[model samples]
Target: MTTNQRRAARFNKAFGNRLAGPLLSRMPGFGAVLHKGRRSGRVYRTPVKIFRTAGGFTMSLPYGPKSDWVRNVQAAGGCQLVSLGRRFDLVEPRVYHDREQRVIPRPLRPLLARFKAFDFIELRLAPAGAGRAER
Candidate 1:
């Protein structure tokens, strides 16, 4: 990889593990985790901001579909969610489209705008069972 790409990768890895993971765990409605691809089997942990919807918990991937975590979620159809020192299994993910992006709350628009450069994808995570550990 190019120097810049290498730098970004390094930064993402460290930030996800050391910073994002912990912070998301403390949030009221957040359910972030480290997920792996079932096919490629590559591992990556992403800090996802989740919103509760009528269907379930929808997590927007600001970085878009090209991101490793997004791709992994697609491949695995499921993932292990780590939060508040607990791990829970997530169900299959369904990708949402641009038109549907508008459904995202207005308050998060600025944060979502940061992904304008990428192909955005949203995944709804369903908790496998009741009383799943928080972190």
Candidate 2:
């Protein structure tokens, strides 16, 4: 992360996200990941571009793998996702860096590339009725 990129990121987090989060949460191919902070335990809902795959879902790490939301999800080993008015339990977070962005859908690759989102996170859906009896 260069100095300028860091500054821009901070600016986006402070202002841009406030406006974007709500819109993204409701958009197609986008979703909100709900996870708890590792240290603070406070929950966070982060907007992300998520695509369903054969096994699970893949998300473009636009802010990179070190983003707070990513770290929290990784630490917790799972997170809940809400998209298109549906809910999902995602587990086994795997962050990978790929220049080709092969895991991303064809039409959306260009947009993610423009954002320098080379890193991606993949998660598999929890088995059906898994832990249903727990709660």
Candidate 3:
């Protein structure tokens, strides 16, 4: 990672769980969580903006395809989403293909464009009540 990338990662690691967690919960369209990679088993808890869609709650992987969290969610087939003091298990997350990219909402276009260097993934969560129990 570049120096700035490393620094950002460090900042995220430190403040993400402690400060970002509660802050994200207060945001109208955001959620935060720690997710474990099914294969590598590494875990990352970070902040994400979520929107209610026809299928379910959708969040964009703006950091792009190489992001460890994105890969982990893909491998694990789901992830843990925490918001407003509640946690839910997200399932069936899939990367956004070329055609699907055109449909990304305009409000999120800027955020998604920032990660243009990396491929984006759109994650859809399972129903609230159907989430797996927290460990």
The candidate scoring highest on lDDT is 2
lDDT of 1 by residue, 16-89 (tens): 55676777766765766567766666676677666656644567655445567766777767676665566665
Candidate 1: what lDDT? 0.61
* Clashes (candidate 3): 0
lDDT of 2 at 124: 91
**Model 2, span 24-117: residue lDDT tens:** 8778989888899999999877788888898788998877898888899999998988887777888999999999999887887898788788
Ranking by lDDT: 2, 3, 1
What lDDT score belongs to each candidate, Candidate 1 first?
Answer: 0.61, 0.83, 0.65
For each candidate, what TM-score against the reference? 0.64, 0.87, 0.66
Residue 15's lDDT within candidate 2 is 82
TM-score of 2: 0.87
The order by descending TM-score is 2, 3, 1
- 1 or 3, greater by lDDT: 3
- Please identify model 3 stretches exceeding 4 Å from their true place: 1-11, 14-18, 38-43, 97-104, 111-119, 127-135
The predicted structure with the larger TM-score, 1 or 3, is 3
Candidate 1, which segments miss by more than 4 Å at Cα? 1-10, 37-44, 82-88, 114-135
Residues 71-130 of candidate 3: C-alpha lDDT, one tens digit per residue = 777777888777666677777886764534555677666666665422445556576677
